[model samples]
Target: MKADVMPKPQNMFQAYMLLFLISSGQIGVGIFGFQRIVGMHSDHDAWISVIVAGIVSHIVVGLMFWILSKHESADLYGIHQHLFGRWIGNGLSMVMMVYYVMVSVTIVRTYIELIQSWIFPTFPTWVLSMTLLLLAWYGITGGIRLIAGLSTISFFVILFFIGTLYISPIKYASWSHLLPIGETSPWAIMKGTISMGLTISGFESIFYIYPYIKDKSNGAKYAQYSLLFSNIIYLFMMIMGIVYFSKGQLTRSIWASTSMLKIVKFPFLERLEYIASSVWMFVVIPGLMIYIWVLGRGFKRMMGWKQRMMTPIICFVIFIGSLISQDREHIHMLSTFTGRCALFVVFLYPVVLFLFQTLILGIRDQSDKKGAAE
Candidate 1:
């Protein structure tokens, strides 16, 4: 099959929008409760783990860009077909498509769980699941430019939420809570970094969206900047969680970031956490749309399916997946599975693929030269 074609100029977005797309994608449901998971591994030094994960994400994204740069206007699907022949390549691409679908399910279900747990105990999981999926379907159908626009809006919504964090949470933080930070063992910090894979995984979406970037040269630069921005936000939140709650409390607080917002009070508006939880849909939907869009797009490329036909099918699958996994134990299981898969898919696979591609190209080049000489 021909390599993936370049998107028309009207469909392309600025390289700068990548900053929003990548940043918003990384800062979804994972941020709300990631502190507890990271804290369980690294204790107060969880901030270090966050930094390490962020650096590794930067490296993985660099590898992805390098791979794409070696090919002309190709996305991940095209790269796969080029690296592995069509049969093996389609198999791997299908695996990635399934993974993206799981990611969408995880994001939507986790958000629904948060809403039901925090705001309305009796709310129907299917209702919220269908609602979010419908919103995602609308955005996905609008196309990449609309998806990018949603991400841009999500970025500022994140900023607004971040600004709210300082208002109340900062006042309660205990500076000495983070004392002797490096006391956590290196092994523990590494474990924490591994646990961080899921939270930081969305940066890999760059692989699929790279072909749609208007300025190819600036893609890597802006993508790196986006990762840096996400890292700063995560590090800040990690430190806040460390200081705002006691060690025991921090480990137990599932939604530590949202929990921190509970103290923000306005005379006219009480229960700010409830408001934050509701408004967070704006942040979550864009990331969800991006994943679903990529999943649909991958199928379209690999099987010659229409994205419009695949979009609803993908969303319906995710919606059913969300409804079936409503309880905490099942949600935790799904999240853990996704996280483990992400460690390989988002981090390890790119480096391995890049090296394998380089070796293959080297052997091919040598064979071409030998044949020419003969």
Candidate 2:
């Protein structure tokens, strides 16, 4: 199969922006309530699980870069075609596209849930879903360079949200809550790491976005840096959740990160979480745009559908998916299902693909050498 055409110089972005793209992509709505799920298994040692998950992500990302580096100007869709052939590869690519769509839907619905729960109790879900989908559609139409710029801005918005957490949440922390650490068994910590699958899964965007990066050699370096940055933010939030809330409280509080923001009071404003929830749209939109762009690009590469024409169609599908679950139970079910799928797609698949590719190349090389000798 022919390799993908290299993006134009003006369309490509600097290697450094990988830091922002991967970081913003990984730190979405998951951060708000991941503490409860993770803490349920490992308790105070949940932070250790966060570290383990981060290390594992770094290794998986290394595998992804190795795979992409083997073929010039080939993204994940092209790699699939080369490995599995036209029929099977397109099928696999479609699976990935579907997963990306599901992830986008989860982010939109979950964020809208937060908005309705915290700030506006009577807010209609479809209205917010359409509004966010339109914003994401606009960003997708602008192209990858535009999405990269939004990711950069989202990085700073994340910083602002974290900065607000430190001000009030840390004050109420009970350091003793973390006493007698490492009491959790190894098995439970591993379970907690598995539970963290969804929150840390977004860095895999590197697979599709790799071909568009201007500096190929340094791409891995910047991707690792982005993972480290996100891990630090997650670690901080996990530790704070452990200290700020009692064991029962931590497990019960669904939106621990935003719940932590409830205490930040100023002379000017009364409810800080209300403001944080609203500003979180800035962070959510960029992530949604990145995933939708990947979906549209995947269809274009594998099925020859134009990204410009397919983008709005993809957003409409996401909108429909988002509207499927309105209650907390159904939304939780969607997030949980997505998290489990992410474990295989984002983490395990890369290692499997890398090993298979290496083996196939080795066999081909040996055959070529034997033929030349004969």
lDDT of 1 by residue, 289-342 (tens): 989989988888888899999999999999988888868999999999999999
Residues 14-113, model 2: lDDT tens digits = 9999999999999999999999999999999999999999999999999999998898878989888887789988898888888898899999999999
State residue 297's C-alpha deviation in candidate 2, in Å: 0.6
Per the 3 Å backbone cut-off, how many clashing residue pairs does candidate 2 have? 0
Model 1, CA-based lDDT: 0.90
lDDT of 1 at 31: 92
Pairs in steric clash, model 1: none
TM for every model, in the order presented, reads: 0.98, 0.98
